[model samples]
Target: MDESWASTIAQVVSQEYPAAMHHVQHGPGHADPRELHPAFWGSYDWHSCVHMLCSAVKLHGRDSDLGLSALLDQRLTPYNIAAEADYLREHPLYERPYGWAWAMQLVKVCRDTRWEDALAPLEAQLEHNIAAWLRTQQWPVRHGVHSNSALALLLIFDASPRMRPLVERTALDWFGAERAYPHEWEVSGHDFVSNGLAEAALMRRVLPESEFDAWLQDFFAPEAYTFYTAPIQVNDPEDGQQAHLIGLMLTRAWLLREIGKPDGTQQLIDAAAAHLTGTNFMATHWLITYALLAEDALGN
Candidate 1:
């Protein structure tokens, strides 16, 4: 809840364009990132751009600053949103679940119906993608990165209430029976989400409180939670992949707090604070959003 931290993040979200970029070329004619994604061509990558937009919108809502509101309005104009929708129409699978989830989060955070109306086409396409993905996917993605199905579903659950039943059903089908995940194999050096913890977090949101508590007890042994209480070591904060451990810490903090575990919360907070000191361009570009998310989870 630091105003300065929020302002710093807002500055990055608003002004960092044509940023230290990275993308995958699906085909030719994919020239500039800005041309490919009019509304989300900043903050280094597509998903980050989308979430940073969400962050800015949410921050403005909390802070109620005219300048911040105008900044978001300028960037999320009807024309820009329509162009983003067009891009999604042409390339539905461009960022898949990650970018799609953040796009939905963007819609969820917008207070104006104009922004929602502008993003309708993109939202519809994302919904279509979710349904199609559910029907075709026989198994859930267990990775700790953007490809994780549970993480995407969690975002979708917040963004689209109509999608909730389907998402919950799919989650129960995919992870309901899972238990005793191998925690020793974690800290994968490049993990933004803890696969095991992310699934637990999603289930906590979808299931009844008592049911979720029982499920957590069954799914994760006491030692598993204890194992994650310690901070993950990042040998190279400058390396984008290794820097993901910072996100892992912040995410774990939020997830743990959400699930009513307080002991691990401070540990994760301290860990995230320590990691923040060593942040480089790789982590600085996107980690602030995760840190804010953690703060929100902690009710700071």
Candidate 2:
């Protein structure tokens, strides 16, 4: 990641916490978002806050001189983390599979450090919640957004090796037989993740190399190659909904790289970068998470 990007991510993660109450306020005590989700009360929403925090930690490593260390040290305290877990406990289904998955990814990157211990309480809660939910989560959400099951499984597969069996079984059960996904008209108006490519990314992790290759060959029509291999154009930059298209570019680049097709990856990333030209909170708060994924995949 660039030095400027490190600064931008740190700033957004530290500030821009959800300005208003988003979740259902069950009681009178939890009024402020900061009070509601102490450790993860920033970046517009819980899930975005969690992943942006992860991006900050990943970019600014152990001895990084950036303000991220101090910010993390302060927010990732035991008290704050415990409050976050408590929030999850109270609202059992809050953030559901999407937020839970990103929270695990945050913990995955923070492992082997003090951040891990700070997040231990939340991690335990997530493990318990996800285990119970997976058994009942029989249907796969094929949307190109937060509810999508493929992206959640991909994150779980990447973050927690202990959950590999569940992840594999869930993936194969849901998407193993995928063939003939109509690629010409796959994405929607407001999408941050490509549903088809997201499934491909997860399948690459769960299936063997030979099997994945064969599955890849059969998953999409020839039109998908052309559609996915190019960058998406954003007509409006300031609109948050349109920003979802910008985020999709970075996500597709990373997922493509993950599935072993690096062609046009840089073009996709660069095109996304060109539109990230302003300080619009609409795109700033969560875009870095996708940007980090793109950078990491390209780097590897």
Compare the candidates by TM-score and give the number of the best one: 2
Quote the positional error of residue 265 for candidate 2 in Å: 1.6
Give me the runs in candidate 2 sitting further than 4 Å from their true place: 17-21, 27-30
TM, every model: 0.90, 0.94
Give lDDT tens digits, candidate 2, residues 121-157: 9888988888888989879998888898899989988
Error of 1 at 39 (Å): 0.4
Residue-wise lDDT of candidate 1 within 153-220, one digit each (tens)? 88888789878999999989988888777777776768888888878888988888899888898888
> Whole-model lDDT, candidate 1?
0.76
Model 2 residue 34 CA deviation (Å) reads: 0.8
| lDDT (Cα, 0-100) at 113 in candidate 2 | 74
Model 2: worst 10 consecutive residues (lDDT sum): 13-22
